[model samples]
Target: MPLALLALAISAFGIGTTEFVIMGLLPDVAADLHTSVLTAGNLVSAYAIGVVVGAPLLAVVGVRMSRKHLLIVVMGVFVAGNLLSALAPDFGWLVAGRVIAGLPHGAFFGAGSVVAASLAREGREGRAVATVLLGLTFANIVGVPAATLLGQDVGWRATFLVVTGIGVVAVSALAALVPYEPARPQQSLGRELRAFRDRRVLLVLATAVFGFAGVFATYAYLASIATHVMGLEESSVVWVLALCGVGMTIGVAAAGPLTDRAALPTAYAGLGGLAAVLIAFAFTAHITWVAMVMVVLLGAVGFLMTAPLQTMVIRFASDAPTLAAASNHSAFNLANAGGVWLGGVAIASGWGWTSCALVGACLAIVGLVIALTAGQTAARRATA
Candidate 1:
């Protein structure tokens, strides 16, 4: 991997930390801002809205800018947003700051993937993209936990300040390491929009929305399940989450090389494995030891498909990969929101805590079916 990938990963790390650390600090934030914790929870939704709206919007806006320059600008935006959040006077200001910070989330990864692929030695593009995403997986393991602890000990404001510092370092790294690549003359809003017209690109995006949703369905409620279903103490919830992060890192590391060999096949295996793991998790939740193992498998199988899905969208939309690539993150964010809602619905319906896993399994199966249909259609098109 190029040193430039290190820059992209650093940017990803800062973004990931700021995004998730808020979850742990909601109580503190609510206390400080004189608001309810439930209201503070809206901060998370605010950031997601920014990501979904900004990903493609920024990609299109920066279509003519140099990739290197665009990356730096977005990271700069990230730094500013974190700084604003640190100094925010009230909850509303904090919410706006989070949205500002999130504006660059999808855009950075979108352009960063393209830049990483361009810099890689031939045939290693999948690995390069995965390397960039490693920062995000590692963030779950290290960044979010550390930041959450920091927020608890010092103050929630301090956490954002530290993240701002990380953003600054990332901006400097990107400026120093990434090579200059001028915008292609053929690249335009029209060309990028056309990429969405391709059936393969749409299918791949749909696959991401549904496939990754399965992972989030269980993940969003894992703490509740750990306590209610698995009979674990509150303190043990962190360990379960950490173990899931470990599983995510392992899965992403393995996905790179597998995707390089065959993107669609890798996706097929990942989605199939995800459905199996979720079904197994539904049955195993009552067994504490087995439930922990299932958590690891759930994270692993759920993330295994990410690299291949990202690679497929980029390749299928080769003419305007940036927008397509960025849209992939937006799709995942949609999955996040949708899965959380569906999981909540299942629980609210009087089903047990483990019922979410069954819902997740059904979602994974749906994703697998879509992926298979996309593959068969592509094959038919090629044969024609």
Candidate 2:
């Protein structure tokens, strides 16, 4: 892989860290900002909303800009947002800061994926894209855990400050490493907008929304599961999370090659595996060791679909990939928000915490059905 891909991965790492580390710091932020934990949870929602809004918005607004320059500009936005979060005086200001920070999340990944694909050798584009995303998995492994620990040891503000520093490094790396590509004169708002009209593109995105939601449904409350369901101590929650991260890393590593060989089959296997694992987790949560293994499997099967889904969207929207690729993240964020809400509802409705796994299993099944439909539709279209 080119060193340029490393820069993209670093950018992804910083973005992933900032996005997830907040979950662990919500209690600290609530106490420090004089708000309820429920209210502080809005910080997560604020970031997701920013991603859903900013992905397409920034991709379109910067359609005329070179991918390299656009990446630098968005990473700059990321830096500013984190800096603001680090310095915010009140809860409202912090929420604003999170939104600002999130605004560049999808745009960066969207542009970065294009850049990574452009840098790859023939038939290796899937791995190249997966390489860029490896940073996200690594963030789960290293960045979030370390940042969470720092927040607990120091303060939540200090954690944001560290993330701001990471953002700075990312911006610098993007500027120095990513090669300059002149803007494509053929690209326009109308052309990019048209990609969304394609049924195939929409189906791939839909797969992301429903399939990935299954991952988040259980993930959103993993700590609670470890404590309330698995009967693990509070201190072990971090280890459980780290174990999940390990699974994520393995999943991404495996996804690249599988996607390169057969994107649709990879998606089929991923979504199918995800459904089975989630159903199993519903029961495994009763056993500590078994639950730990399930957490790892859950992460693996859940993320295994990411590369295939992303590659499919890009392939289907070949003429206008940036916007479509960016919108994929928007869809995933929607899943994140929706899955968490559904999981919470299941718990509130007198179902056990393990019931969230069942909910996730159901969502995965729906996503699988969509994927199957899409595959059949594509086959018929190809033959026609």
Candidate 3:
């Protein structure tokens, strides 16, 4: 693997930490800010909103820059967002900070995947993208839990500050290590948008949107699930998250090899596993051991879907690999927002937390169906 992939992973570490650390700190943030727990949850929603709105826009804005310089600039934005979050005086300012921090979330990985593939041998693109995603998977296992603890002990503000430091390190590493490829030949904001005109490109993007919704639906309610379902203390959320992360690391590492062998089949199998795990999780939630096991499996199944999905999108958008890959992140983040909103609706309507699992299962099945359609489309195209 290229060392530049490490830089991408490191950037992913910071981004993932900032994105998820808030989940563990919701109670503290609520108490400190003198707001309701549900209100503090809006911070998570706000960040998702940012990712949904910013991913494609930022990708387009940064489309013309060298991938290396663009990454550094994105990290700088990420650092500033975290710094402002650390110093936020009120909830509104914190929301603003999170939105600012999240703006680069999707674009960075989208563009970074392209850069990673560019640096790899031709047929190893899936593995290359998986290498970049490793940082995100690792963050769940280590960074998020550690950062959550840091916030609990020191202060929530300190967690953001620590993430700010990580972002700065990523900025420096990217500048020093990643290769500076010249801007894409004839690539422009308009040309990038043109990639969406392809039907297969649209299908793949939709696959990403619906496929990842299952994970987000469950994840949005994870802390509550820990307490209400598993009978765990709030503090145990960190450990459970770590268990989930462990699953994620294994899943992500395995995805590259699996996709390299059979991309669509690998994706469908992973989603099927994820759907089954989530449904089983609802019933297992009351058992500590079972819940722990299920969380790990959920993480594994969810992450295994990522690299192959990216690979599928890149292959589908052969003419505009960069834009399509970047847009895949945009679509996934859109799933994050949509899934969470739908999950919220279920909870708010008195369906209770277990409803999240049911909702997630349904979403996964939807994704699986779409993947089947995409597969058929690919087969027909190949024959034609």
Give me the candidate number with maximum lDDT. Answer: 2
Q: Tens digit of lDDT per residue, candidate 1, span 314-380?
A: 8888888999999999998888889988988999999988888899989999999999988987888
Among these predictions, the greatest TM-score belongs to 2
Alpha-carbon TM-score of each model against the true structure: 0.97, 0.99, 0.96
State in Å the error of residue 346, model 2: 0.4
Model 1 lDDT, full chain set:
0.90
Candidate 1 collision pairs: none
Can you write out model 3's per-residue Cα lDDT over 225-313, one digit (the tens) per residue?
99997899976878888888899889989998888889899899988998999999988888989989999999999989999998887
Worst 10 residues of 3 by lDDT: 317-326
Ranked by lDDT from best down, the candidates are 2, 1, 3
lDDT of all the models against the reference? 0.90, 0.92, 0.87
RMSD of 2: 0.8
Candidate 2 lDDT tens digits, 29-83: 9999999999999999999999999999999989999999989999999999999
In model 3, the clashing pairs are none
Candidate 1 — which residues are off by over 4 angstroms? Answer: none
Off by over 4 Å in 2: none
RMSD in angstroms, all models? 1.2, 0.8, 1.4
